[model samples]
Target: MKRKKFASLMPREALKRSKSAPTIVVIGPSTSGKSTLVYVLVNHRIIGFITVGIGDKSQTTIIPCNFAFDERIEKDEHFAMRIRIKDFSAKDVHIEILEQLAKLFASNELSTEDTLDSIDVEWFQNILEPKDAAYHLGKMEKQISIEDFKESIADVLCAIENAEPSFSERVKVKKKELAQQKVKISEIRRMVFEDIWGSISDDLLARYFKWLDYIGENITNNLNLLLGEDNSLGGIHDYSANEDDIFMYGGTILQTLFDPFEPFSLIVEDITLACRPRTEIITRSDENIPLRFCLRDTMGLTQIGMDSNSIKDALDIALNCSPDSILLLMNLEERDDVIAESCDAIAEKLSKATKLDVPVNVIFTKADRLIGNLVNKSNKETVVLKQDDYDATILGAIDNMEENIRGYLTKLPQKNGMWLSLRYLDEGIDPIQRALKNQGSDKFERFTPTGLYQNIDEIIRETQKRILPEGIETPLFVTAIDADAPAVEMKVEGKMISNIFNSIQNVLTEDNSVVNGYTITTKYTLSGRSVVAYYNKLQRGQGHTTRANVYGNFSINMKAMLNKILCNEIPDFLTLYESQVIGTVVDNLIDIELEHLVQEFDKNQHYKDLAFCDINPALISKWSDKQRNTQILHQAIRQYFSSSEKYYMVMDKVAFNLSYGNEQIRKIIDGVYQKPISYDQTMREMQDTFKKIFATQAFSAIIAKEIGDAMTDLINKMIILV
Candidate 1:
């Protein structure tokens, strides 16, 4: 009954007044079920893994993707209501808009009793298998000495660097000797596993390896940054190379560096799926309602080496943000100690980055799997524990886990540190894992879950007290419902997910998190607004001689295009390319928000200077997947727009939304303004023109519509990547 009442309240009720939704960044290792959790959060259904894509949920979230619930509310003559869930996008947006309008016409009954419960229902069965990533890692044979393997690689590199082209026999014999010590597949796999994750079985190293793909990928993509080297040395002195053989050794270092794994990374960059959930009632006294926030997904922990690129992008997001709390997720099947230790490392890094004491809440995923063990192992085990016993076991295990992770969390000077270690609250609110170092010499206050707040306004009021802005992190243990598994006694609502959503919702609605409304202070350029042209695929290579580089039977010329842009040659063919890039950038956010983001960009930072970046035109061989391609393009746009010189001077001035062959624009922009641009002189002349353009907010409004059109426009067509 409480669960039903909880769902009945609109998510908006748990917020502060703001222009943009606050961001709740979700960080964890791979195989953590983040994508499905986001999907279910928005759609309220567990579509089978097959429908989600390959059994790998890790790969499904190519960017830091977010999911939000779509509300379909219908009021009954009585006070009771049934609120269905859907994503706040697509056709559902229209249906919901109508439903909202209908509510204005109908009257709602005055509540005699404040107590009302609404139940959430699942529409489909969960077909998620116990898809494990580290299951085989530990069991691999470790006969290969890691030290020896390193030595051999070093020897090979030494041979390559020292070998003179004039002599051949000696080099060939040395190369043959190195080949004899050929590294086997198993040996290399173990080396990679140990190198990336640390040693197996005993410590956080294992957990790091286990989740590298997930959380690690999240950094590169952050749903979208699962964010991403080499050298030489010694004993192969006898090896000599013939002059003609010099070419054979080319790219050897690079090949050897990446020989252990495929070049493809599962996720390309951070993706954020934005959402709107409407399930609350309007309070007559309430004012300053805040806009909802975005959720950013980040990659997990691994034995990140300096030579690797994956950790470079992720470290900033995973550690630097100033959050009110940290929702650390731990898999139940894994060791509690490992999870605790890894979480501590995160907390430690977070403390160093933000220097604030943030709460670290360890929420365990796949808790239901504890019950599954009763049935699956009923025959093999001597005894099976009941539901109550399992609950006790889990609670007791948390107590034990505190001790394991407390060592890292309380490592402050002279004292164990002041924390809800659980420490005291400020504004009746205190950070979970902030820089515990500065919170005085007091001992840990205590440890336990801070009870749920009855009024979300309390949270907002508390947050406003901070002099500096800080975000809150809420860890939620997602409910795992397996349609095939036998029914268990646990109530779905009893899980901590409800509390998590409420906490996250409250954080998202903060004023500081929202975009501040801004007035236009910059000049506009509309001289080239009328410069429209039809986009033609055949015309792409016409701008430059190198524009049509051959790749298989097709032509996707990224190199030639870049060269022309640098040389100030704005080609007409780029119009089509720019459209594709813009479409992909908005389609997938590289660690940026989704629904709330559009509104955020629309309101405060409108009229972004048009520019282009990357959408994977090609790699070393062929085109990459949609995820990486989207990431590449999204980053490119972000890169171009972010640079003052690149954005304001070069691309925006020269490339005014290129269109080719009638695909986009039908009219021709002949007698194009082909003249040298003197910024100082040009600005003086166009001052009045820009003033007139700024008078109308047309350009400001066009961007939001353009993003919308890009989404709808691509729906009818497909860009094939083979």
Candidate 2:
């Protein structure tokens, strides 16, 4: 068989160029199907080129991979990122460190000064060796030595031949056609040596898999290890897969095991995800709003790294990328705890802890899977669910999600969450309402956003009976992904994604709600059925085979959502999140906590390393300088916030902190009150020291011991007559 040329990575020169277009960074937790979604959007240009690692357990992305589908635009301007920046040190992953970075960025502790002058592109170039690993894996993964593989094959055939379940009888009793392949395993291997090169017969493939299924669980796991993929996700014999999908399946496995990006994700970048639809949605009263924006994916946050973080360089990158919007993807399969973590992490990264940062959308992926699970569970005894029951079940699931996020998604402090409302309304008021007020009604021609909010409420009241509880106030949508769905379908989705970019662009550009530049459009969908799936049950089902179509509002959008929540100069935020500010007050509190705690006298440096006589005057000056102790106790706080944009930290050079406007941290005197680490204890120690030196210890010790009455003798010696 002739081999096709394998897809390769974009060149180093291409990777070094910075993005110029308005970017949209896609971020999500691992297994959110992020890479697969990207592949479907770009439609197949990337499918054969990069392995998306669909079925593996370990992480596959390494750095931000910028993807551009447009030939006219430079590819360097847009990026898909896994922002676990630094060297490729996978074992050294520090969620706390990354969280601290995010927190510092959000709280303004980190800055560009701490960043490397430039990303080391040369270092990134060296990781291409994974391609060779892929080659070997795709070729050698199918077999052990000839004898061992034959023995394994024989074992499966023997099991079938002497079947306890009577396999041949079952195949015969059913009307199922038997596979005609009579060949052994060795005969099949000659047609293809690599996984991606096959166009083999299904009958022959089935026979091979049939043999594989006879093996015990322990043996199957060992075979998976030999093939160089993790067995945790699945065994080597995945019966659920179609016979032809083996090639892509093999590619996913190889990518999981030896993916070039895995090491790179450990470093500072990520690479993957592209697609923007050219379609438009008709607004209320019939106006077309187009969708046009670049997509980028970034490193996912760990459980801890999502909510609270302090970092600077990541913020600098954010400023550099200057994305017009942010889209966060969440897997519906995640536990409730993970859902909360994902939301908190995103809110913090966008610099809004209480709610999502401005111009952001939360997209829930895998909704289809969630629905499938619930349906399957219901069908366990009988495939029974009425239309109302089905809708109610999904609503309950969404309600559970809302409940988990109630703490973080509280009502907006003022303005009913239209708080810090846009100072300038960009989208015009509805002409119909204005005309009506001008003609008949004198009072209802609302100029403010008050009318728009009221209009939305009326629409929701009229449209659907179910709405998420009022307490969960964040702008949220749940959409299902099909990974390979058509552009028209856009996953089990069509609406939210189609409308998201247009709404965000409007917010960022004009701070407005409607695309028509008129009043907020009442025509937008508050909730409606956009996902439709037709499925038939297996003919073998005892409950009787049936075909039915399910309609769901799986994809939802709240048009102009960002317009309500986005405000760059929100003073309420400054006051509400003041605890995040780290400056003189915070630093002083840190100092007081860390210093001033008095150690015992024997553990003091001047006493521990030397005897009383060993400390000469010069040595005493050095220790008081004392020579006894090595000073392990250092001044505590680093990255003191000096302003909203800059932070100061302690470092090697006294002047190093000055570069970023940081304060110079003075050295603390060991076991003494140099700078009060603990103010009260240090003062008590000072008072004791003052009493011993000038009040009592100043008198001769030998004379006091010799005298019967020390105080009387000392007073008489001083001046009896006086």
Candidate 3:
């Protein structure tokens, strides 16, 4: 045969000169007709591809095939060149990995960082040597010697002809003998271990063995049945393919490659998928555009006994590609509920894999089935196929399909979708063209790793702003006796106590709720020395710390009166006053909470990694310190009224003992009545005099001083302790 050079990896210089193509990995479940669509698209360059099943039963692809071509963009004058198209079809092994990946995706265990240490381009390239016509033709004949092969063929023919033992029975007997004569699995394992490929880990070897066992038990039996029967091979005696052999100047192997119309089983039942890049020169009436691209037909994530390593490889490559878009194909034959569930699961997986920013185009395949249903039902309603009559129904169906798709994908980070079918090509609408039209995308946008770091830095800045109020250098207020006598500021600074600062800093730093979505965090700190200095400056002016006097040398009667007015009763009264103060503070800052600061902060970090460990620790430390200090200051002011509670308690007890005697009041009333008979007027005068004496400056000063001192001591102690 006049053979042409087979496709190979593009040269480095050629790659550098050519425009880079955007890859869109085609992913779906097995038997979803992924390859069939690819086949149609590559063969017909006019409109696009179809997904109608080809061959009797679907033949699995054995190799990851690449179909690279130039898709002409004729709409805009600016886009006259052909867009590179790479379509990849997965093998059974790759499909299995995808299935496992789907399970992990559903459980939310899958991550984009997963690695396939042993699976790479080199691994795939080394599987088989590229051969030409002569080598392939030589494989057409049986492997055994001529004599043995002829004898075996004659015996098989005789057995079939006699029907003494039916063809199936004879085949089974041959299979049984072959199985009995086969090398032991243990011996094969030893041989494999001794081979140059011994670098394959024992764990991987075990998995491979398990996979082989599965194929032997489930797939091999069924595939053998198909091959031995009147199916893909077109019956045992039907050797009509010989005509192509003569025409191609080779044999069956060479003929399949040269013939365009022949059905070839390219699907591998084993082996994982890998990318294969090709170059093509697409010539138009106006110009010729040379394009370079790679197509990777990812495995179906909806199968059994999947390989984790392969799944990891697929995920790693897809994510690293910075793919301009993703084409997610789902089979529409499933019920709406199933489709919705699958969409939701896949959307979550894709969101995590793509970091929730890449645009995804959801495609619903098997539209032909829906069209058939519409036609069959419509036939009952109308005599002929009329576009006008079915327009509303078709539109409604399409709308519903899109709605269902959107409903599930809405939960995903990104939303983009379309539906298609290749069954009714005679119809007016062309889905392939629609799909191709949607290919040209806007700029590829993503919140990159660097962007994530920048976002964290921004958050730290904003958090710093919110933590400490502007122009408030000293968050603490302390009363001083004079210029010396340990100025309040000096005392606070020398003591190294930051009760207010530390408390606030702790809240901002340690609390996860403060910054839920920010993975990169920072700690905030307040300058203790600066705060003390600020407080001391304030003490020198009218803006001084609160001061009060604690009463001393009190008589028993005075104590009783104080207890009655200042301890129990006064404490309750003060609580009511404190509540009012707190209420006012909350009301004034209502706008802060209403603004949804946390929500805004979270939104800022939405594209970033979700967990705490992903953030930079050094940044987090700085942010935390500052936040804690601010929170502590806020709490100090918020609960300032607590200082008065102690004084009120002491006074209330004294007041309880100092009962206002009715006898004394009666005597005064009696004297007034006896003298001028003006009892009511005289009684009012006496009451006013008593109130003045009890509400003197001395009493107020003492209580205020006691409360202030108690509070100051408590604050200082807390700051130092932390």
Candidate 4:
């Protein structure tokens, strides 16, 4: 069977596109698997190293390793080095392996040097065999000073220059030279070790040992700070120990192994002692590890005299690289109040100062204590339900807790965008480690028996989507359901329909067109309203009932379309009048003789009305003029003509009516037009005065009748206009 393997299988086209993949920063607490994530991203392998200090954590492993690939190196140069210094067991093994190599080199050199001395003795015996006739070779070997021995060898080599030395002769000469140089080489090796060990004073070494002991105590005080303490770095076997002595011893052994190569370096400072610095040795190879990571514990904020300036300095160091993501480490088991307060301050400052959209991931370390309590309760339950039953309850409880914390945080005003995670005891692998490995890929798509990688892909994908301009549409449909009802009950369908409509409206209004001049028309229909409820007993049924019916249709045009209504209706009063008149009279009095005259008068008066209506007179003057009699007469006549054709034919109708009316009323009507009733009128003067008064009064009466007729016509015209 073929061995299974995990590798990125991006298409060639996808690979091309990935050339500009955005950078991502993985930030979390010390044991939250930031380094492991970088490992999996580049090497498809898990790096089991645990970083120790805040400053010593890995920045990036992939980019540096990739850079090293350009420099020719053995083994592809892309291998990721685990920079976690606190994983003592693994570090110990690494140190032991290198120490063995160093010992092997020493042992081989010593043995070879001894063998060369014996060979030189044998060569001297061969040269001094008495019958060989060579010049006193044994005496020469003893009597020659070391400097003279080297000179004689050089002279013999010059005398034999034309004569090619045989392979056997060359081997003999090489053995003798190796024998002479053996003691000097041994001294040189010893001197090298001495020089390395002597760099620090005995007092300094003693202090380091004491500091190492203190570190062990600190680890016990905050055990989660140590590798494998919370099971995050891996399980602790017999190797688990909280002793500063052991850590320091381990460090010494590590230094001996790696100091030769200068693979990595870290500066350690004592926060309580004015930040006194010390350098630690790492790596044995001459070439530096592509990535170097470090970790350091700082004094508590109170211990450090938590001034704003000092806190800012620490934050600057923590955020030096402007990490795309920030992990705020909070030890739940420690002074949580202090941690929470510090985090709030840091978050506030970061948000105000930086334009970088740093997503903060908060790790509640020592979560095992909380988890253990939950698990114990779950186990003691009487029912032996399926695994999912237990898991669902636990996850639901956790989710509720998470939501409560989020709600509390959101109220702070400074805690926007902070995400939370519990640092669960690593049963076999770190949850954060699994998250980092599964991100940017589709391997772990669902929640497994263990929710190690829960929602990781969602977070990463969302962040990437925000950064990239790729036009990927994600369709989200929301249907609001009443929680009191069954899951299948849909209280409000298309809950986001209003939002969708608004979005479309916004787009159209902002752009003035959809796809340029192709106006968008939106229509909404009320499908139906439905009622669902559980009933104890019904006429025919015992279970719940669901009822649905059609409601109605409702719509609104785009503002642009509404503008068309205004443009067509409000400008010219004459056009509006003619439209109303044609609509009414066209059906009522199409053949009337006055119809042509009405149409002709409207055509001639159109331009004048347009011009006069355009002038917006002062309201006071307009109102005052309306109260005068002549103005009123003119208005009444205009209204009459505007209302109906019968106003224009009023003389014809009035003459016919008057002739047919009762004689007495007809006489009164005709007398009013002929003369005014004047009590004191002289024969000639009275007739003139009566005629003048009659004409004025008659005109007023005629106008008043016309006004009444026009009002009747206007009422009828309005019905048609509406």
Candidate 5:
């Protein structure tokens, strides 16, 4: 994409030549130097003032005042000119003069002072000589034709009424024409000088020039209307007075005193009595007279009656004025609730009404009051208070009066509104001054090194690690104890838990790759089975056939794999089981509480990294009498399953249901010599039982499928080894 070029700033030459002027609206708390500043800027002239009234009554400044320096000039004895300065800046003065000079002059070469000085006796008398003046005035009156001057003068006299017209009458007519000529000359001269010299001027000239410029520009643009306030000081009790007296005594006797010729900058000590709106009194009767007053008119600076409410009206006016920035001056010394409330209300309304996203700075006018209260004061260094501190004190006060003034705005169900900041201007550094300096800086960038968004990111990362499950592949099951007895109580035997955890880990990590110096496919699932002997028989009976089939198919395959491992076909299990025994001894070093034992086991690296191992029941019988040894092994397995808390934990973690209809199958197997049960019937019954178990517990079906796949893989490896 092509980069766009930046627009050039307005040239000084163009600004000088431009006829328009900018308007500045100054507002602040009652005595915060608004009017004083305006006086100084206007060449120390107090052109306007605002009266706030005395005591409990509220008073306002009304009417817009225009101040400018007028220079009068004379051209010849008959003509005089008035040149009014229109605008002023640091560079030069802009002025308006008469228009007649355009007829005789092609170039503007005459200065105002030069033009005024040139009006000496010769030029005056020469232009006003009897014959010449008569001829000129006649031409002006269209009384005599240039071709027949003599005859036309006689005819012009005949048209005059019954009279003896004097020579001075003609000269009087000539004077007016001369005055018109002087005005024209002045206008042309001003235009010419401005064209050449631009508006550059010395300090004194610059001040007056700017003053005049503001007046003319404000008047033409209706800015005065925007700044004007209502001045009728009508008492609320006016109707009680008699009709005749009402007209005389209804309004307050106020006067709007202003010095229009004064300069822009003048220090004003007290505005309360110095400035007042003008008023008149009327009499209705001897005892019922009342004061009458006129509503101050807007000085064509702005239009009146733009809105229904005063606040909205003022806001509309402010927005149109397009203030560079707003300074909300609050007087902290008075601690006046009403004054603060009014300021807040105005600020809120202005923010809502304005088009420009103008920054508003709330300046606390009397910060010296809080100087003594500051703790942790930095004498030589600038103190920086946290946002919370400002919100607690300054904002808290505003919120107290206007309950909805603070952060309550965010709770409202609305979108796309202005954002505001609550601040205390402070004694040392003025917030408004800082705001003016950084008016257009990035709002989101933090002034301090740290911010809130940085803290939120850290919290979210910690939460993610705690909740997501972790493993390397599919068909993975996490072993956890699932015990139920309304809550079972058991002494935590550290050695037993650690042995179980390490045993599982050893099985899972065991290498099954070497057999006859050949690499074999050796992979196993690290799984845990419940050792609790007390089973839910009712649940088992409901799905007897289905459970039997599952045991015969899946569980039997897993059992076969264990048989191979136990028989030393896969020597890794021998080492794994041996390690489990040794690890159990090492576990006795730790202390454990029963409630905490479950979580500790889950957190253990041994349990998390454990691998599966297969075991054989037949090996036990072979070591002794087949029947007696088999019974002993069965009883031992039952006791282990029944007594170990880890048994139920593994069932829950793996989501396994071990109840199967093996009792009937056992009976048949025991009576194998007496009555032979068909293989078809037995296998069919097992399949039915497995299907019923899966149908009864859908979640168990998910675990069963995963276990089945793992078992199948293990069996295939064992078969290959055999």
Candidate 6:
């Protein structure tokens, strides 16, 4: 009897205002059963939750709809808790407009009781004018005139008139379709002209006409600008001329009550929810406690802007509420990337919207669908399920689904995640209740003003670090030193050109790392070749040739043959000397130069190619002397051996000394050769003869000049081998 009496007072208690109740904003995707959840939470019944039917197509909750209930907690003391649930509208603008309306209504001086009369002009400018509906229409006003909007409507009406020839034909079709929520043109016209327009006063009607005129007169001068700019219309600026005129252009008012473009735009015919907070009372632990909260619904993040003008308004309303705790409701009955993306998009938007680090709690609804799967997992597939086992099924399924949701929500920036089935609301709502309780806990301070500012700063700093700037690098210079050896040292006149190398030493000796604002690197190569094998390659390339030339005095007629031998053998000998001496010196100089160039390259990644100074001129002068010597040898051999006197003497010896009748020649040919002459002594004599030939100044100059030219050519090629 006590329970019965308390139940009877539910209606009366629900009507009273509960000022101390905490506000909870319900945010989730479209048709996530947010409104239904509120109905059960407040009244433990689903009936009369809203004026319109509840389902996929009949979701009429377009504004901030408020519901309240009471809960009693038996803590150390019996504390009664009043909870307020604010359910939002399907359209985003409605939430934006209603948030302001609800706040003003709550704080109004004349609001002795919660009533629609409290919603007024301050609500229009601060809230409704900034919303997408009014803002977008105002922007597009220049693009759309009253005539254009009316003409589009006329075209639709004309098409409908042709399709439905008679009034009875239209009525029959409308009745059949309307029963299923399939609206027809005639039904929409009736809803707009008869029901909507008939209720407005003459003054409001005049204002509506004037707004239409304003749109027609101002066709968009820059449609592209209108589309891009967020604040293009300068909202409600001109409406200040007549305060009542602003109301006619209110986002909710113009689009909801007196929609003038019903036939042209599908959105114009849609219902607009006037979401207001409703308070209710409940008795727990024998205490009557009022629970005050606000439920804020938004157009699905994925759906709102794509098909309607609700995206901007939805975000604005969310920002305005400054929700202490947000509930991200996801449906568990289906799984897809779209659903996941919507959840992610909403979570990100909420994080950016509030200054507080408000916690986002993910609630996966419709867990009942997983019952069969859970039952199968329990190995009871063949067994008939009973009512007693329902709890087990729900528990098992919720545990599994929670793990799956956690897999996803963990990746998102949210706090906790849970699953619920409205069918088991008696037990299912426990998770939601626990989440709601967290909002009042000590940890909630992390989302306060000071905490938010610190978090924002950290985020900005981290973002800055990710971008690299051009101003942070130090320039580097490099050089090399062959300090001890003069042969390989780079000499500009008597002084070595080692300033670059000196810079490196100065920095190192001074215990500093850089010189003249540049980091200096130095590489030192030995002044001379370390191994003979290193000079062997230089010999093969530019100095030595395989064939040898024979140079001697010859008769005039044999001069051509001697000249061929002299050219081939004499130059070949000079080439060998060129390879051993001049070639080695030039190669050493190039190696040193390249070493410095390479050191510079290693220190700086920006230089991809190498360019260095030409081979040292002093080294070239030394090589030129070698070339002159080789040329002298060639000149002496050619001039002495190819002349008339030397040629005649060579011919006379070949012709007369080797005559057929000569007895000494015959004896040598008859294998009567005396005991072989000392082999080592003959080789020694031949070497002495060649030494004496080249030892002449004329011979040395010719060979030196020629050999030097060849060595210089080799050095020039090696330096550019970058």
The best candidate in terms of TM-score: 3
> Which should have the higher TM-score, number 3 or number 5?
3
Candidate 4 lDDT score relative to the true structure = 0.28
Residue 26 alpha-carbon offset, candidate 4, angstroms:
3.7
Please write out the lDDT profile of model 4 over residues 342-451, one tens digit for every residue.
55566565652243344544434434444334444565445543434334344544454456456436534435333233333342344322433434323222122123
Q: Tens-digit lDDT track for model 3 on 1-722?
A: 22222223222222221122323555555445455445433323211211222322423322223333323221111101111111111121222332232232223322222222232333322221112110111221222123332232232223223344443354455445446557443332222212212232344334333432332233223333433433232111211112342111112332232222211222221111111111111221112112223334533222211123333334433433333345555667767766666655654456434432334555566665664465446434567655444443554455555576677667566555545553434213633223223433110011112222232223222322222222322112222222122111101121122332243234333445422211112121112122222222211110112121110111112223333334333344244333332121112122333123222223343312232335576765676432433333333333333432223322322232222212232244223322211112222333233344333433333333333332332222111000
Cα lDDT of candidate 3 equals: 0.31
Candidate 6 residue lDDT tens string, 181-217 = 5555443333222222223344434443444434323
Off by over 4 Å in 4: 1-20, 29-263, 266-315, 327-335, 361-369, 374-400, 411-454, 469-722
Q: State the C-alpha lDDT per candidate.
A: 0.26, 0.28, 0.31, 0.28, 0.25, 0.32
Better of 1 and 5 by lDDT: 1
Error of 1 at 46 (Å): 11
**In model 5, which range of ten residues has the least summed lDDT?**
525-534
Sorted by lDDT (best first), the order is: 6, 3, 4, 2, 1, 5
lDDT of 3 at 115: 21
TM-score to true structure, per model: 0.29, 0.28, 0.30, 0.26, 0.18, 0.29
Q: Candidate 2 residues 1-722, lDDT tens each?
A: 23222222222211221222234555555555556445443423234435544333544444445543322112212212111122222112211112222222223212223222221333212222232221111222233233333333333333333444343343333222213444332222211111111122344334443333222232334434534442232221221112253222333432343343333233233332332221111011111111122455433221112222312223323322333344444566767665655454444544421122224444455544554455445433345644433433444443454454354344212111111111113324333233334445432223333432343233222211111112222111111122111101101111223233233243434543322232223322111101000000000000111121211111111111212322222222232123232111112112222122112112244323333344476755566311122221210111111111211001111111111111111111112332211222332333233223212221222111211121111111111010
Choose the strongest candidate by lDDT: 6
Which candidate would rank higher by TM-score, 3 or 4?
Answer: 3
In model 5, where do residues sit more than 4 Å from their true spots? 1-22, 44-61, 65-313, 322-328, 334-336, 357-362, 366-722
Per-prediction backbone clash count: 94, 40, 64, 11, 77, 60
Which 10-residue span in candidate 2 carries the lowest summed lDDT?
532-541
Off by over 4 Å in 2: 1-18, 52-56, 71-293, 300-321, 341-358, 373-722
